[model samples]
Target: MGILNKFLEKTKICVIAEKYSVAVEYAKALGCSKKDTYFEGDKYVILWTNGHICTLYQPEDYDEKFKIWKVEDLPIIPNGFWIKVRPGKGQILNSIKKIIERQEITAVCIATDSAREGNLIGEYTLMAIENKKNVYRAMINALNEKEIKAGFKNMKEDKYYKNMTLAAQARDEIDWLLGTNLSRAYSVIYGKKYYVGRCKTVLLNLLCKREEEINNFKQSLSYGVITKFKNDNCEYAGRLNYALKSESEARSIVKDICNKQGKIDSIDRDIKSIEPESLYNLNDLIRAVNRRYGYAADEVYDIAQKLYEEHKLISYARTDSRYIKKSMINDVKLIVNCINIDKFSMKKSDINNIERFIKRCVNDEKVIEHTAIIPLEVESLEEKYKLLSTKEKNVYDVIVENFLNNFLENYEYESIAFLTKVENYTFITRQNKVITHGWKERKKQDKNIVEVKEGEYVNVEDSVVEKKLSKPKERYTDDTLFEVLENPAKFVEDTKLKKILRESGIGTNATRALLLKDLIINGYVTRQQKYIIPTIPGIELVKDIRTDKLLEPFFTAVIEQQLQQIQDGELDKDELIKDTIKFLERHIEELKSIVIPDKNNDPIGKCPICKRGNIVRAKDKGYGCTNLKSTGCRFFISKEILGTYIDEKQVKNLIEEKQTDVLRFKGSKGEFSARIIWNGNKTQFKKF
Candidate 1:
């Protein structure tokens, strides 16, 4: 027998924490005796649920017929949801059951994190056990002694949070209903297993569209003429805004402007000030850590949570609020003073200017359920910080930077612009001058700004036709992808729908990272360095399923709006459930016929070296001959070479003609055009 299970005979109450680390903390603050994983106090016996000890039963568990996926039986809407103990959690749960069942235990405490999902986890676990004891909710914002004691003192009857529980349960069932049913219907059509959800499927569609756009994107090379001017003030260059359609036109413009006289038309200088970044909300923290350390959103969240739970080094990591109350300025200052100032290159004069910038950091209206993430005020923080892992320190530094930067002055600069005219052509140049090295402390560029009187004539020394290539939009990086997920309204065209989506987004702050992680785990998405790329299998899933109702952000936004209404008790949950089922029924019956290409059945082209084999997509990427096993042929082509993305048409042309048409490739010196030659033996690049 463990600590609480064996010695709970004298327990006055039992406590259930959301996670093990939290349970351990409660044990300390409650003066409980710890043994094994459970703790025993004079009045309280405590253990942990380890996050959702019980979850809803899967479709297979509900019935044997549902075990095998079939389109006919899809849209698997259950009559009622039931909870069962999750796998591998039976031992701790049994221990908890034993602890709570003791006659000495008069009441139970639900000390889980204060959130909708946390409420669900605790409520579901209790529901699975069929506990009859009186239950109370302990909403803990921090894991300190004062906060824990305050939480217990202010604990309310579980019945008081019934709406929150109901809201969470409704969301849980709706997600299970939608994700489980829709994934099954789509997988059947895909001819292989595929995961799909309202949020992730749309994200996958966006990724696949990006991949297609990149492959189909053809760079149009254009030329422009620039006149280099040399005068007593400085040597500078400028150009007209228009791009020359043909090289001959650019050459003619250059010839006309070379060695010609140009007069300064106007000179404008303006000073501007940029404020420091806002406090670290969950989204902002995720973006900052991802940008600075190349960590994914999920990893950043995990690290941030560890900092919150284990070290108690920062406030709540899952908060959405980027503002604190105006009264918390002293609290923020305490933190800044506690931490070592070695990394922060602050100005001494900025210390007296703290009151000037305090307005940017504090706003009572913006403060929500929790305050912004800031370093906890502690004297030992500097010592404890040195023992942290590099990643933890990196994420911590970003939070600290955001907090400390608020005390500094605004980043101010001066922008000087000049416009020049040579004959009928006009040109412009801009130079930025740094004034205040505040938050960013960024320096000026290499270009020098020179003074010029209006209407003063200057000599155009030389001119040349500048070749420019306008490429397609960049691939989706984690940073950009997170932004899109947070603000999905950008993907839609309707202004009203955009407004709704901006309010609720695709997913909640808590679920966004986990959703992205699940997509990556199931092979629908992947991380190629900083980019979140959609795989070929991922592309095949959403290639033809895209429609305005399904692909647009409005779809998920409507679900969010309905869920919010249900949470607010404005609409009956059963009504939402009925509408969801009807939606599934309509969508399943109306699913578009998408031709998922079978590579084995439909190859791109025949292999040039080995005519017996057909070229198809390789495992990771690119294309390779199918007869590599039988004939030992090694013919293959990559998707990219020298930073240029290749298309399927190029692969087909290379196989049929034994040589490809001139294509652009990046060389060591610069970007150049080349042709691939298959000389009966191997491939060779023929550069122009």
Candidate 2:
């Protein structure tokens, strides 16, 4: 009876935020001073979730047959997708479940991030708890006091975001259906671990195609005739439109034009207006930082997230929108006023036009789930800047600069084009002169002008024929690759397909960087300075699977489009899942007939005992003598020595030097350090 009374005295309202930091902020605003894993107030209890408390079940979770890799089990599509509490999250799940089950708790508030993934997180948590209470969504962009309060005051029913949850679930199930079945089939046929994904495979195909083009490219020599002309103490340069294939042809033209008088046939001048660039989305931000500071995409993302969550100096960073909502104009103005532009290296005149620039960034239709990443209205800008790391500071400065440019005037310039004729050949020269600095204060353009009037005669100061060779297309850097991934249609040949692909990119802005990181981690690609180059395995993988539908970027785009339709309520979720299953079943049969070529079997080293058979990699084992059956040489080494898996490089080192470098191993007692020594018949460890 006492326990029942205690349960009856539970809180009326429970709020669940996505992360601990966000929950703390919300708790402070909701008058919850006392704290534990959750903060308790008189009428409300504020709890936090660690990202996602639940995830889709793994393949083995569906059935025991999935434990082994077999071609027969090609398409493992479950009748219904099952949800499981992610490992290490059971305790939190139980706590939240108990709170939800409490009879006194009348309503629940989902104060997670304002995006699809956030909606999925909250909905999945509720589903895991088997919640049936009234659920409300507190959609707020930042974790500030004002926004949090406003979000609570204007909470919407959880059913409003049901479509978003369905979309997210569809994406997960589709990726699983394709990735799990295809990865296992290829790995089994090739005898190596080959992990595949829709986005990752398409990205790999792009890189491989580019690599092939680069490899097959042949350099061809070409010659150009360049001449310098002088008129009225001003000099200008021009190149002939035609490029000669032979040096003799170029020399003949240069000789004919040398020391000759040329007349300007026409001179055209026009004012060119350069508009300010759109604001930075996540993909654009990643590209900008990578190009400027050589920072990886993940590193920049982490820094941006820190700036948003810790410093509260910027809006949400994981956004794809480049424009703010029309309703945010007043808030944007406040943010602009809060920025101390005097501390930045900017002209006072540029600062005066802040209002005008701010108007350019406002567009209701352009805004998506979140607004563009802009500086927030903080109390002390200088103090926040000081607290940021080098990379964070760099990213903050970029956002601030872009925000300021919206208020500045357009960059104005004048282009002057001159067509000079000597004999029958025509040479064209062009120049640009800046009329107004405007946004160019941050990004300056080259201005090199030479005054020349129409029909004016000029002497050819000098003429030269230079021979050059055409180079292959440069390799993809992080900056360029991000752009391609964002808009893959730029490389597509078909006009209709390109238009469709541009609408739905290879991956979302939030996940494109992760896809690249995964490719590098999976040995599909390597980084050579700034460029991404495909490895031998990557090249072969592309060659082996190029003809399959899985390598088509458009196919992934179609899947993404259907998910978007699900979000918009234009398509039914069950129908989408059924279609995916049908597609997978058709492909799995086609995949079985294709023969995967065996990889090159490189011997580790010559056997020490027999000295006849070479040491080769043993299936699911470490290494073994190839003549074990022929010559009765039963020499083999286990993959794991002292509870640590030995890699190929370490195995080779042990065979050649009789010992490996210092290695760490975890035993039954505890983790210990040692060097693995290759004994004649067996291996032993020497403590380091």
Please write out the lDDT profile of model 1 over residues 464-541, one tens digit for every residue.
789998776677877787788778887778889888888888777778899889888998787766878776567766
Worst-scoring 10-residue span by lDDT in model 2: 1-10
What candidate 2 gets wrong by more than 4 Å, as runs, is: 1-11, 341-348, 351-359, 442-448, 491-496, 546-548, 596-688
Candidate 2 on 425-520: residue-level lDDT in tens?
Answer: 999898888888787664554655687778889999998898787766767888888888888887668887797788888888878888888989
Model 2 TM-score, 2 decimals:
0.84
Error of 1 at 427 (Å): 1.9
Index of the highest-TM-score prediction: 1
Q: Residue 231 error for model 1, in Å?
A: 3.3
Clashing pairs in 2: 357-406, 357-407
What lDDT score belongs to each candidate, Candidate 1 first?
0.79, 0.80
